[model samples]
Target: MDSPHGAAVKAEDFGLKGPRGWAFRGIGLDAAPGSLIAVEGPSGSGRTCLLLALTGRMKPTEGHAEIGRHRLPKKMAAVRRIAALGPVPGVNDLDQSLTVAEQLREGALLQRHYGAPIRSLFRSRAERRATAAARIDAALDAAGLDLATLPKGERTTVRDLERLEAVRLSVAIALLGSPQLLALDDLDIKLSDTERTEVWALLRSIAARGITVLAVCSEAPADAVVLRTGPKEDGAGAGRDADAKAEAEPAAKAEAEPAVEKDSGAKKDAETGPATATATENDADDTGNDGNDDNDDDDTKGADDALAEAGRA
Candidate 1:
């Protein structure tokens, strides 16, 4: 689990404050090297902030943390040097305008400039390019990003990628630095159930290869150390907590209902619906139109029109 820049990251009662309020407070972690840590919480609950704080990209106003040999706040720069970030919004992010290969090359250049010895600058351009290529290949392999599988291979722009594919590319770019710890924010965001499972498995595989991983998710793997953040964690009365939970349940259901209802309604309409402008039209069709006559043509026409409108939308 020992790495040049990798070490067990530990935090003791660490916390940070933002303009809105406390991002997180009284949080703790004791992740071993190469272990997977999941910071689980809802939206705007400081999961992303906690990941940055632990990685030394963000300062913790209270308590302390250790990343590699560096301590937070005091040695923020040193900590950032060893930790690699993925999709953290303002910190480190994949460039949407660049093709996959271009991004990889950029990462390799940055790594060499910062990580290599000063004497390496004297190396021939060809040699440096070769070194960069090797590092990119290794990093991509570690990240499980198969460029060949992409629609345009390495030439594909980042904006065109699937959520999971983009995540992989970001992770691969981070790995180019050979970071001791790989930390990603919002690992499960906008991903399907199967994709989430695959991402967790990928993180686990990265950890198995001796790189530490910190991921943010709404739900953590069973074996992961879960750090939760939210509005309800502070002191609160049992009555108030109950009230909050009672209130929150309906809100959550309300947020989820539209999608479920839309899907179910569409399916029902597809199965049994016959479009008529008025109730009388249905009655007229039922009585005057031959019941024995297959109205399949009319049904098919309505369905086709509906499908066309949906397509245009």
Candidate 2:
């Protein structure tokens, strides 16, 4: 279960920009604590950037937000502790070489060292180890992942795990500390309709139990608090101005975009952790537990919230 302190999220006049233009900028919304918020938009529409800002990984250039009791760009450190990411390409990808158990353990260690109460650092090794084990178990259960059911049990390498299993494991790791808010990107990117339904069910259950969830989808379901986003021009409508602009600067626009590769091809990005899929244009996230600095790339700080990783696994 999430901590009893699950937070409500609110934003006003929030925005972030890049050299190409605004990634996303607008007046934000107010959501009741533990509400399910879906950010829906097409690729390059700034869904990923929006997720980063809401979670406090990226500071907004224009407005502000209240995540729980903390404020953005001010108390973002607190926001970082309460919110975590799941399967955000470039931020939370699985380490394909490691077994499921190993990933869980590593994630637990990372969360404990960076996310838990500072007093935990003073605990005895044995006590910490026991706590970590229990943490993993609870998170796996909460995420609906039963290690024993896997083909090789917990010993299965991420390389061998099925797509759904990979998704579950990614979620399970993010829940290790039972963060009050969970942010999952690319919610409908890879899964089939049935798989997407199952994932939504899982997210709903997580939210119902008091952990707020922010999901990215091509479109929001009727039941969610939807935050629709896309490229800057989307807000302006598909009029002649938008068409003319794109037609006039296709090459420049394409060069400036940080591509999200959905195909099987893989290439490494700069500055973030290993395993990040190369962007045809630029980079923003890395898949794994480590994030990057804002200055490192035009992409938002990848590791600023929940050692995010990106990977098919």
Candidate 3:
């Protein structure tokens, strides 16, 4: 389906090459309204890079990418308005000093402060506070975060919460703007399997509500349309062929041995018995050809007599 913003995202021949000569290339993708796409690859394989490009946070060196109706600009203000990016774990940028409730309230206020006209800024204080509070509460509820359950019930700082709770708070802050597109980076990083499952379920539920969801993960979820990046196609094929060759070598060697042994055994039997019989016949002929049989006997008898005399002496 076409997005209300015209096109949700479009990238053509997008690529990024680092100073170290490592590169990720050959990417072409489109994400539309009500669509959920996932970028999956091993560490350093450019999944995060691609996600950033699609969200207009980073520009591609070679190709063009668009989010909503705007091409990536030197400044991403327009794209940032229509899209919300979730926080990266371990990054100290999610307002760690503020309480969960305060963070959500601040997020909504900031979006309004930046986007609203200056004429509206001078509105009555009571009306503005009521609007901001309602928006913050709605965002927190949608994220399944209840600040009332915290130690000080809306006054608890982020530093006091567990890692999972912090992540949920970050999600709530992102959702406060009610963006048309949600870009989540490393959604499953460091999460337990069950926690990952829960997060995926939440994302799916969000997508079901009609927001386009794009996430970068080490592996793709079952319901996500995965865009994978890694080695070149030829390199992958060569590796598979090499593995197949290695597996076949042992079986080929095993089949060859029996034929060699049979040939050697036949040769040995053919030579041994005949050669021994011929040697015996030659010995008999040599004895028969000693025509001076009596002389031979006399010489043998003399040798025996000499040995007997030596023993007696």
List the global CA lDDT of all models.
0.60, 0.63, 0.52
Q: Which residues of candidate 1, in runs, are more than 4 Å off?
A: 1-5, 232-313
TM-score of every model?
0.71, 0.73, 0.66
- Lowest-sum lDDT 10-residue window in model 3: 271-280
TM-score of 2: 0.73
lDDT of 1 by residue, 1-313 (tens): 1233346888888876533345577888887888888888776666665776676444566778887666664554455556777655433446688788766655554444344546667878677666666666777787788999999998999989999998988887777666778888778879999999999998988888888888888899998877777763543212321222232234323322332223423322221101000111112232323232232112222211321211111
- Specify the poorest-scoring 10-residue window by lDDT in model 1: 271-280
Measured by TM-score, the strongest candidate is 2
Residues 169-271 of candidate 2 have per-residue lDDT tens digits of: 8888777757778888888877898998889999998888788899989977889998987556545322322222232233222321333232322111111
Instruction: Give the clash total for candidate 2.
Output: 17
True-structure RMSD, every candidate: 23.7, 10.4, 39.2
Cα lDDT of candidate 1 equals 0.60
Q: Write the per-residue lDDT of candidate 3 for residues 182-292, one digit (tens) a residue.
A: 777677777899888878887786777677888878889887877887764333222321222233234223322332224433322211000000001112222323222
Residue clash pairs of candidate 3: none
